[model samples]
Target: MNTTANHTSPPAPRVSKTRRRLPVLILAALLAAVPAHHALADKNDHIEARELLKRGEIVPLARILEVVQQRVPGDVIEVELEREDGLWEYKVKVLTPTGRVRKLYLDARNGVVLKIKDD
Candidate 1:
């Protein structure tokens, strides 16, 4: 019986340095992406809405809606806040009772209608 413990040890598991660093590298990559994402998001939203609200730079959305309803009688279907040529405007789409879609652009600061378009 040649039971000499086989005179050999089991082969060692393969361990690539890259494999060991993969998780750490992935975490690092994710961490690096967060700040860049934030920067891009910030660029798109140049206005600090909360700060504007606190400083009264813009009127409340309810007031804007009221003004819109008074100017153009309809149920609001879509609303968008857009800053154009240094003007903060609310682009509102209203569905009138007569089944007409009217687009209204208003000054967000004082709830004044800027333009009206039939859609």
Candidate 2:
């Protein structure tokens, strides 16, 4: 009861545990979903490719490789099939004996070489 004055400050705001964990949970869920979606898309693409092959719509990869080897005469390294503008194409990468790389683009339906690029 002397000349001392009481100074009372407001308490700090409280944050619930759920509120703090919400952002983390949302981020984790998003990260988990992306891979599943990508995997599903990949599986679908594979099924479609198999169906096309069975229907004789697209040439077999083995035949395409044979055609490519006959034309380029190299060790085939990589190959990919793609559908562009409603037409299927095969991209083949070859490593030549002279240590050069060549990219060959072919028609997937007929195994016809459409274009070639050397590197």
* Best by the TM-score measure: 2
lDDT of each: 0.65, 0.69
User: Model 1 segments beyond 4 Å from truth?
Assistant: 1-47
Write down the RMSD of all candidates, one decimal each.
18.3, 17.9
Estimated TM-score per prediction? 0.59, 0.63
Kindly list the per-residue Cα lDDT of model 2 for residues 1-119, writing each as its tens digit: 68988889899889775575455434322222122224334434655666778888888777887898898987666666766677777777888878999999898789999999995
Candidate 1 residue 61 Cα shift, in angstroms, is 0.3
lDDT of 1 by residue, 25-81 (tens): 343222221222253344324345545556887676668777888998866766656
Among these predicted structures, which one has the highest lDDT? 2
As a whole number from 0 to 100, the lDDT of residue 56 in candidate 2 is 82
Error of 2 at 26 (Å): 38
**How well does model 2 score by local distance difference test?**
0.69
